[model samples]
Target: MLNKKAGMIAAVALSTSLLVTACSTQTGTESQASSPSETSKPAKQETLRILSGVVGGKTPEENALFEKEVERLTGIKVTIEKPAADYDKKLYAAIAAGEKYDLIYMGKGNMDVLVEQGALTQLNDKIKASKVLSDPKVIPTKEWDMITYNGGKIYSVFNKSEGGTLPTVRQDWMDKLKLQQPKTLDDFYQTLKAFKEKDPDGNGKDDTYGLSTAGLYDIQGFMSAAGVKYKYVMDANGKRSIPYATDAAVPIYEWFAKLYKEGILDPNFATNDSGKMRELFLTNRVGMVTYWDAWVGLFNNMKKTDDPKFVAKAIPGAVGPDGKVMLRRGDPSVWGIPVNAEHVDTAMKFLEFWQSDKGNILSTLGIEGTDYTVKDGKYSLTPDGISHGMDHGAPFPNNTNFKNPIGTLPGALEGRQIIFDNNATIENSTKDWPNAEKIVTNYAFQAMMGKMPAADAVKKMRDELKAVNLID
Candidate 1:
């Protein structure tokens, strides 16, 4: 009850934070000199209110920069309120009350719900008029519209889509074992067998497992590599049906059960979350783990505290069941500005700055000389990299040139290159693989709950999807 009350209070605070305002009079040297005829020139000075989840520690400095640049370009005052963890709860309350906010930064799923409820402003007309929607590289309009509500009434800009797993192994251990990177499914099995039997981590005990994958979302990473996709129910003549009683999902569970029985996989994976998995990796208890390129930064950061020499690298590829290289899923972009504002002109100006060569660099890279500096052709920041984490500093200053900047965060050395290679492998291998969405989603969580056989779960999903006409 206490928790619920706290949540409600937090939600109220978030929704109303920017709604109530104490209006202020505007006085400017330039305003006094304006021609009398210019008095009707749209409201020249207006305030725009925004609600967001971005933590703001260094925000004052960045806010100052934006304020100066925005006012000089368009006469508007922007007041941004960014909440932290309880953001979702607060956002929903505001939506329920029809609270007004000029802009909002939110998640894809919630954005969908809000759009359906008419709580969000549609930017279709504004986007077309602005002409930024025409640039494919800048905004992959069609693909990103999947994130929009019906009729492409875009509510938010897509951020970045990432889906691929780069399984990082302990190279030093592999070298000690005289093993070449496993190229075939059989070879991978043998490598795991050896890692389990031969003591790969070199602590002289049978502690390290050959592979570690959790039962939650991480399981999909492994299954995708094995060429499986899972979705929920399907439609026959537009009627929904279950998918956990299918043939396609059976093999997945069978394989996992085999692994579980073999002792090559960590037994506790049925409940391991990312943080727990990270703990396993950091302690060097697991030989390899499935992760995206972002995990590399975490591993790199770990080097400073534990072992400075504990470097991890992505192998060329991992073999799927068909004796072909495999990769994981893809995520869509998730960032953009809204159009419901008194300061629409000024907001548009800020959007231009964000996408502009100057704005792009600032958004991604950070202030020059402070966040990073250019050397030769590359931009570099230290290992302990500066955190805009809670510090709402302005966008990075040097990252504007690359239309599509890859990697988890900006300024990680060679980070984008690594992501590119991983993405390419996933694209190539999964090109011909079936889009087994039903089997993927249905049986996935079963593994997490230890409820049913992974194979049974997958097969059930396939049958169910097929019954409702999901498979061709």
Candidate 2:
């Protein structure tokens, strides 16, 4: 009986083995037969895992069109990972864990730290090899220099010719109030005062305020106008100083304190963020505020909602004590694909495709007829185009340090120039702002956080100022 059972089991096992072998052979044969002639078969394409910020402005249909073009150009499938607001945190954690991503869109303050850690690959060699990318006119060498690290190794590239936060006021308000655009410190204050007392919005209610800059060390817009360091201060002798300590920032705070005490500025301005400031402007509570050219939409929309005749316009570039203006020029951050990744070549090719002529046109003008139209050989926005601008904001004036031949939106390009001219006086005026590492080690940011007395904060700032020249 035992011999009979063993023989049965052996028979079953033999049958199972035969079945598996047959399946394997059949699968291999089918695979071989599936291949068509080289002329008829399509080439195999690679896939790139890309992580980008939320792309705005394009509708679902428009985005689909863009995706089709991108697929055709790169010959690679792009998997987009658009995380929520926690994009930076997730990216940081991923990088820390040595997880690989094909591309990453970095932001302002974080890019410096990432570069210092050697997380990014040097792109100078790669850039030089691409003739289409290396043309001097296509990518300005001076701008590319900013993205270089130690020993002139380029790790990243910035997009756009320029960007900044500018102080804009209602031109109609100025005309009604008979006020000149503020050119000096005193004029700035006076203009704000007139706006506060005179109801620039034409509402009989006494609800208007003079200035509406974001507060709590939010110094980009108005504070920069003082020719002081909004983030890092540099003295006449080339010493790095914290603006919180020296006359540069003291005057600004003093002005704020005075405004707060006198009820000329928004009482909550000390705590409000940019969003809140925008809300205030839309509600017609603010006469003048420091904002970006993108706010043109907010102004327009608010006018449409409130009163069509009420116009919100940009304030002329104000003059400083030295007869110069300081504009809050910002930089564009791009996606850098690390060279150590498994798909470096594929990733680079994808970037090249994104910057190509077809890519630029698609990115710059989302969905041709839907977003814009060509009239007399000039690109013009459709009636719905203004909505697209409101949605897309502005493409970085520079794309991967490449010159943007498409140019910027009318208001944005003009506003960017206003910032450049304002800060032009400081071009080479102060040496590079002390590196972030040095600034934090020397200066206690907690004081500026408003936890300590302003006087004590000033003292600590002065002490930290001594390290300004260490870089030189």
lDDT of each: 0.51, 0.56
Query: How much is the lDDT of residue 389 in candidate 2?
Result: 54
lDDT per residue (tens digit) for residues 371-443 in model 1:
4567875766632134432112222221223542323432233333544544332221111112344244446
**lDDT tens digits, residue span 155-253, model 2:** 654433345567777766788889877766667889888888887878788898887766532344455556665545446785554454554565555
Clashing pairs in 2: 159-398, 160-397, 160-398, 169-315
- TM-score of model number 1: 0.68
Question: Which portions of model 2 miss their true places by more than 4 Å?
Answer: 1-42, 54-69, 72-74, 216-221, 224-226, 233-240, 301-310, 316-318, 369-385, 390-396, 399-410, 424-457, 460-472
Tell me the TM-score of model 2.
0.75
Best by the TM-score measure: 2
Name model 1 segments beyond 4 Å from true.
1-15, 19-48, 53-83, 131-133, 140-145, 148-153, 161-166, 182-187, 193-197, 233-245, 304-308, 315-330, 336-345, 367-370, 373-400, 403-472
